[model samples]
Structures are given as structure tokens and as C-alpha cells.
Target: MAVFNPFLPSYQADPYPAYAALRAEDPVHFSAAIQAWVLTTHEDCERVLRDQETFSSSSDTASGQLATVLQQQRREFPLGEVPTVLNSDPPVHTRLRTLLNRAFTPRAIEGLRPHIEDIAASLLADAGRTGGRFDAVTGFAQPLPIIVIAELLGVPPEDRDQLKEWSTAIANTTNVLNTEDALAAARQATMELIAYMDEIVAQRRAAPGADIMTALVQAEEGGERLSHDELLAFSILLLLAGHETTTNLIGNGLLALTEHPEAAAGLRAEPDLLPSAVEEFLRYDSSVQGAVRFARETVEVRGRTIERGSTLLLLLGAANRDPAQFPEPDALDVARSPNRHLSFGRGVHFCLGAPLARLEGDVAFRALLDRFTELRVAEGGAERSGTLVLRGMGKLVLEV
Candidate 1:
């Protein structure tokens, strides 16, 4: 029988096989260990994402282990409990998204391309100074996105490192099954981050700047502005979600290219394929492996009756690989056309930072390939992130 245990080391190493097993035998299976129903097929996952009324995004609707974690988080760190776009639905979510859209417009994002390209070049140049060997996670992947997001949020460049540290702490608690120690650390980090954001927001209000923070502070839709708590929550969410996923994308994409040299070579040969390659990278190994939702009412999925209030784990990584959606899902094809992968998810909560991430990935990959003639994994194996939901590398040494 196939098991849906995400905590297993083997599963962390490569979850696609296990995902494949569950999709074939039991697409909608409940795992007692995690205390949630796991959905593997693309269609079923899409159905849940699209029908927000039936599957809620709010912690108030969560059940079982998810509720326990959320309750404790709220009690211990109320700052993290605010109804931001990530955890809110409909009216609340609609308002938050609308305001955010005004601040994070496409033109604003597009304007950052030249800056992103410069940052990627600078990071690679610094790597070259390190005698041809460096930990890509720290030296290249992590800093590139951190710098970009920090500048966008009006954070000074020097404090980017500290911001990343706090962000990582908060992200550790993404999975409800995390250790108490992890939760405690995350709580402390949440407090510190909120305090810092409060100060920044005040500064932005006092003297507006050409940054996302200033735009957010000034943004108004129908004469409705974000409340103080809403502002803080949205800022915190942006900082956390903005860079972390893209960091993982770059790291994971690099690893994928390293494992499949032919794809890397192909990209180097035909530079126009970078965007398509980035899409494949997102599909093959997503930064966010899955997302959490609550069953608002009893719903039948693939003959399985999911009771109201039950927590559901929509396995996005698995869904992206479902043969019903993508042919030969296991194989990595850079030029896969009509690739409608759910790496950024679907429906109302689809990733807001998708374009930014794609741009960063394109720039990072192009810069790396153009600068270095060869790329190889170092002797020591890479270290994967502790959390299951936000999957990525902790440390991956590379030689160029």
C-alpha cells in the first residue's frame, strides 16, 4: 500500500514516485499521520482550488491538526493570524488583493528587470571571485531574490541579510506538524518582524518613497485604505512570500539543470528558450509542494466523501506531474508547450509574484549560463529545507 507521509527522508529526497503511487491507487486518500486528506490528481486539486466556497482558505475553517497549529499560532503570535490575502477568502481577500494590485502593478514589476539583471550579474561576479567554488544557495540563489524583495519593500540593502533570517524562521512553521521549538522560534521572529515593519510603515507614511511600501501606504481603492494591522500583515506576507519561493525556484532550477546537462546546454544554445525552461523548472520540481485548505462542507471527490471542516492537502507538485494533465510527466522537457502546470496554483489565490519570479529566474539562469562555461554539483550532497510545504535546498555547493 502507498503511504502519504511527507516527513520521511526518502520522500523529501524525491516525492514524485510516492505522489505517482497515490495518484494511481488512491487519488484522494486520507493520511492519519498528518491528519489530512491528500489530493494527488490535477483535476481534483483544481476543482478544490476553483471552488473556494466549498474549500476555504481561512484558518477559522480548518480542522484536525491544522486547526490545532493555527490556534496555537494565534494565541502565541497574533501578528501571524491577521486575515491577509494568503489566509483570507472573498470579501477580505478581495479587498486586500485589490489594494495590493495597485501597488504591485505589472509596469512596476517590469521596471525592475534591469535592476534584477544587474543584481544577478553582480552576484555571479562575486561568485567568480571565490575561486570557482561556492554554495549556490547562499552565494547566488538566496541573495539575488532577497536583495530584490528588500529593495521593493523599501528596506535598505544592508539589512537584507537580517530580513532573510527572520523570514526563514517564520517559514519554518508553514507545516502544522513542525516541532514545538520551530514554532517557538517562528513566534519570536514574527514579533520581531512585525515590530520592524511597523517602524518602516511609519517612515513610509511620513516621507513617501518610490517603493512598494510607499505605494502600499498611499494606495486607496474607493477611498478605502488598509488598516494598520492589514498593512503590517500584507507587508510581512509580501516579504516572506516574495523572495522565498523565487529563491527555491532558482536553486531547484539550477539543480534540475545540473542533473540534466542537456537541458542546460540547450538553453545556452538557444537563449530565447529561457522563459519556457523556467516554466519547466517550476513544473518539474515546484518550490511550494502543496497548499492547505479546509472542506467547508461535505464534498465527494473521486468517490471519497470529505467531511466538513476536514483539512485538505492539495499536492501541487504531484498534480503538476499527473499524466492526465502533462504527458510523460517524469521527463523534464524544457520546450514543453502548452504547459499549464499549477506550480503557481489556480483560482483566487494564485501566486501574485509569478511574473516577478519568472523574471528573476530568467535573469538568474541567463546570467549563470553566460558567465560560467560549466556547472557541477560539489562532492557533498545538497541539504534540503526542513519544511515539507515550501520545498527547496538549504545548502547546495556548486563548482563552475
Candidate 2:
């Protein structure tokens, strides 16, 4: 199969066609541009995500733009380490994940439901007062997650803007700034966040609070507390993963609802379906489009052999739309039950914040419907961000 740049703007706008072609003609196709084998089939993607031994997530060979960024600032980037929980295989991954799991306990997330609902309600009320025209991304999607993360991290509400600026500087795809500048900004952000966390940790050490940060500060494993670097990395991961992915979830789900009126009407009529609708939204258009993994040894997938040390890009978006896995794969079904999607990932490295994300999504969509009686796409089509790994709309203007 001929290799092409999947990061091109054209591909970003509509990757389904390319993904369909790949899944049909070359499910395990290798691309020189990305220097990784593309896994497009649903079964293959699940297999790769589940079997971490054969396919490593250590970021040993992440090429293209992300590779450049990681190589330049290996020590600073939490993900640069050989294997953080999100990027590690078992044992180490298991240990790290186990240590962090207490923070995201089901009771903790459930306890947060009221707070999340309140935040969504307040934001929706503001949107309603604006006479119906609002940028959904800015008005609702962005603020809800930012506030939730800020509250979770115990960061001052006033400082939330700076936190977002830092995250955007590092993660924004439209920023044409040089890699050095981006790295510098990321390093500065890391230091600032760490400094803030250090103070919070000190306070927590002196007198623990009920927040997750305090819990983490006081957490003990085999009579061991988390190292400073580990704590910092874990905090950064939680903030980034917590906000970035959920931001896209809200944005993408709203976009889907606006585009599909019948589905939206169904959701409005039956609010109970919102949870399943969120799941279907995840399946139809996932936030994390693909995850990178390194091949531990020679592995044959979809009739193609991937060499050891090579990178593999498991196309989550493609897998979600695989005709073999989903009936009427392209259509958006709000009531699609038994939706087993890899949007939150799978296996040992599954997303720890999945429960929180679901809760947030359900609250967000329900509040959105309740607040806006008439909703339509203010802008007909979505402008997508250019990042290959994360896929989301750049802006989604909606007339509520």
C-alpha cells in the first residue's frame, strides 16, 4: 500500500474515507510518513490495546511532530518516561495505575455528580441569557472541564485561565510557533503547576483535605508515598487527560446532536437516553482518534507483519466505525446499546477518568437540552484541529 501523510488538512477534515480505504485494502498498513503501521480494523485495534506485551505503549518510536516534541523535552514531558501508566505495559503499569486508582474511585466520581451538574446548569443559564447565539466550544465545552479540573486540583479559580493558556500553548494544533518555544512554554507551565502543587501538597501533608490531591498526598503504598516526580507527572496527566479529552467529548457530542435533529429530538424527549447517547457519540466520533504503541517483537496483524521497535498507530476512530463491528456504522444512533468502544481505551491502561467523563457528558448533554429548546448548527460544518493523535472540532458555533 502506498504511504501518505495522514496529518494533512484534507485528512483531518474527513478521515473516514481514508480509514475505510485502509480497513478494506490494508487493515495493518504501514505508512512511512508516520513511520508506524496503521491498525484500522476493530478487532485488530482491540487486540493491540489489550495485548500490551506484543505492542508496547512506551513511546519508544513515536515519530512525526509528537516525536520531535518528546525528544526535545524528554525529562519535562511526563509521558516521555519509558512507561507511565498510560504508556506502560503490565507490572509497572499495573503498579502505577493501582497507586493512582484511589483518586478516581467510583464513590469519589459519584460524589462529584452534583458539583458537575451545578457547573453545567450555571453555564447553561448563562448561555440562555445570551439570547441563543453562542460558541458551544467556548460557552460550554471548554469552561465546564476547566472548572472541574481546577476544583479537582484545588487550584484557585482565578488562576484557571493561566492553566488553560499553558495547556493550549503545548497542545494547540493551530499554533504555528516553533517547537523550542512550545517546549519552553511547556517547561514553564510544568514548573508553575508543580510549584503550585508543591504548596498544596505541603498543606495537605500538614493537614489533609477531602480532595483528590490531598488523598494522593496522604496515600501510602507498601509504606511508600509517591515520589515528587511521580506526583507531578500524575497530576499533569490527570489535568491534561481530564480536560482535553472531555472538552472534545462535549464539543463532538454537541456537534453530532446539532447535525442530527431526529436524534437530538429523541434525546430531548427521552432524557434517560443521554447516557447511551454519549456512548454512541463516543463510538461515532471519538475524542482520542488514535493511540501510539511500540512493537515489542515481530507481530502479524491483519495478514501484515510489523517488525520489532516499529511504531503502531491504532486508529480508534476507524475502529469505532468498522462495519464488521458496528451495524450501520456510519449512522449516529442515540439508543445504540451494547456500544463497546475503545474511546476510553481498553485493557490494563484503560482511562482512569472514564467514569468522571461519562458523568460529565451525561450532565452536560441533559443540561444543554433543558436550557435550549431550539438548537441548530450556527455553522454548517465543523473546523477540525490538525493534530493526528487527538481529533476534535476547532470551533462549533451553535444557535440555541
Candidate 3:
């Protein structure tokens, strides 16, 4: 009998080997600790994502104790009645996604490129002002997304720090509910976040601005628009989804570059490779590593039967390194084309902030490489974010 416990120090430092073994030996094994069936291979993961009918994103499909847990989550938090885009299924998911697409249009994201560059450049300049040594997490990666999302939502500049605080507290609560302190903090954050967004919604109504938040407030489809609670939930979701994950992406990408000098130098020498490099970073160390879905009904998969209401942990990190999907899958190849990793996941639930995240990564990496010739991990090593669902560092101190 084999198992994958992400809590193990060895796995936290590097889960690739364990993931490889699982892909080869136990593609569809059960982890007793999580009490869920784990899917490791690229094929199985993709199959589960594509066939949402059998595996629903909505927890309403769950039964028994799983349903109890879902109820407990809502009881503990103030997320309102409507589901955010992340944990929903069609036609609820379909409607929310349709409206979301209008708000996160390609044209809007493309326009942010220049602004992203400016933000990245300014941060790098501040870091390099008194020579090159800064906490990448606090100095650059974290604030970039916070500032970007705040501006996009028409949030005042004075409130970015508070927004970051609430977003971080909420992100910490994902896939973790056993602890009293964590859940309490999450509930507090949720209440505050909702209240804060509620104020923004009111302000927008009074005098709409030229920003995405205003657009979402006024967006109508067949005379359909978000209600009071839906508007607040959407704003909170957009802030958390856009802010926390991309910060991790930037931090993780920089950490990868620090560890792999040759690849970093290559990226600097050939800046054209930044886009491909971003994908490789995502594959190598995804920000959101895995997601949970409830089994709509009992279904046999890869010779095992998953019962209804059973939790399914789709290992996006493991699937990205499945040898069947890539040559030398463990190796970080910035130039690896045809790279289709499930970091942001697949299907209708794919990350809406993917383009914005990629743009931020491209800008951040190029600016870092161009500004500093030498880059290495600083003292105290790196802290692994202790969450089952999201894989990222707490802080990445760098010497340049």
C-alpha cells in the first residue's frame, strides 16, 4: 500500500519524485489522511476536469458527511448564499462565467500590460536603489497584484494594504478547517471583506467609475445582473483570486530562477523566452497545485470505484510532471513548448486571471533579470505555504 502525505518534510521540499512514483505506481490511489481518492496522472486528472458531470464543482452534489462539511464552511464564513465562480457548476457556473468573461475581457487585460510593466519597473528600481536585496514576497510579488486589482476595481490607493490583509487571511483558510485559529481568522476576514466590498458597491452606485468594478456592477445579460450579495461576493472573489495567486506565481517563478541559474541567464539573454518560461515556472511549481471536487455519483476510474460524496483531489502539480505528458518532466525547461499544465486547472473552472498573471510574470521576470546580473536565495531558506490546495512559499528572500 502506497500513500502521498504532503505534510512530510521531504514532500514539502520537493514532491516531484513522490509524484513521479505515484504516476508510475499508483495513478489512482487513496490518501487516508485526506480521506479522498487521489488522481496523479495527467490523463486521469484531465478526464476528471473535462467530465464535470461525474465530478461536480458544486458541493451541493455531495452527500452524507461531505455535505455536512460544506454546510459547516458556509456556517463559519460570511460568503453569502450565491457561490463564487470557483466552487460552482452549471448552469450557475455557466451564468457566472458568462458575466465574468465580459468583465475580464482580453482587451481589458491587454491594456494592463503597460501598467504592469510600470509597476514592475518601479518595484525593481526601489529594490535596486540601495543595491539589490529585498524580500521578493513583500517588496514586489505581493503588492503588484494587490495594486493592480485595487486599481481595476476602482478601490482607493489608501485601501490596498487593508485589502491585502483581508485577501491573505482568506487565502490561508482554503482546504484547511481543522484548526480553530485558522477558521476563526478566516471568518473574521470574510466578514470584513464582504463589508468592505459592500461599501465599494454602494460607492459605485452613487457615482460609477471607469473601472471593471463599475462594469460588473452595471453588467446585464438578458436583463440579468448580480444582486447585492452576488455583487459583494464577486468583488471579494475577484480580489482574492486575482491578488493572492499571482503573488505566489511571481514568488515561485523567482524562486525557480534563483535555483536554476542557467535557465535564469538564458531568460535574460533571450527575453523572448519569458512567456514560455512563465509556463515552465507554472508547471514546475504551480501556485494553485490541486483542487477538490465532489463525486456526483459512484464511478469506476482507473480500476477503482469512487463513491458518491467522496472527495477527489486532482493533483495538478503531479500531473504536470507525468512523464507520459512531457520528456524529462522533472526538468525545468523554460523553452518547453506545447506545455499544457493544469496549474490554473482545466475546463469551465480554468483561472480567469491567467492572462493577467502571465503578463505580470513576464514583466516581473524580465525586469528582475535585466536589473540584476546575479540572483540567489537569501538567508533562512524558503517557507512552504501549509495548505493542501495551494502550493506556494510564504516568503522568498533573494540576494541580487
lDDT values for all models: 0.87, 0.78, 0.82
Score candidate 2 by TM-score against the native.
0.93
For all predictions, the C-alpha RMSD in Å is 1.2, 2.5, 1.8
| Residue 254 lDDT in candidate 2 | 86
What residue runs in model 2 are displaced by over 4 Å at the alpha carbon?
Answer: 1-4, 61-72, 76-83, 172-178, 380-382
Ranking by lDDT: 1, 3, 2
TM-score of each: 0.97, 0.93, 0.95
Higher-ranked by TM-score: 1 or 3? 1
Clashes within 3 Å, all models in order: 0, 0, 0
Which pairs of residues collide in model 1?
Answer: none
Tell me the tens digit of each residue's lDDT in model 1 across 216-305: 899999999989999988877887788789889988998898899999899989999999999999999999899889989998999999
lDDT of 3 by residue, 1-400 (tens): 5578876778767777888788888899888766778899889999899888889887765654434566677666786457878888889888888877777888888898898889888877768357556778888888898999999988889999998988878776665434778777878988988887888889999999988888888887887887788788888888887887888888888888888899988987889999999999999888877877889999999999989887888889999888889888888899998998998888888888888888888888888888778887778856766467676778787776
Alpha-carbon shift of residue 218 in model 1 (angstroms): 0.7
Ranking by TM-score: 1, 3, 2
- Give the alpha carbon lDDT tens digit for every residue of 1-400 in model 2: 5344675667878888888888888888878765667888889999988897788877555454444444546655544463557766777777777778867789989899989999998887767355657777877888899899888877778988887876666565323234666667766776777777777677777887778888787677777667766777777777778888888998888888887889989998888899999999898989888887777887787668877777778899999999998999999999987798889888887889999999999999998888887778775535666367676777787775
Instruction: Please give the distance, in angstroms, between residue 98's alpha carbon in candidate 1 and its true position after superposition.
Output: 0.7
Give residue 282's error in model 2 in angstroms.
0.7
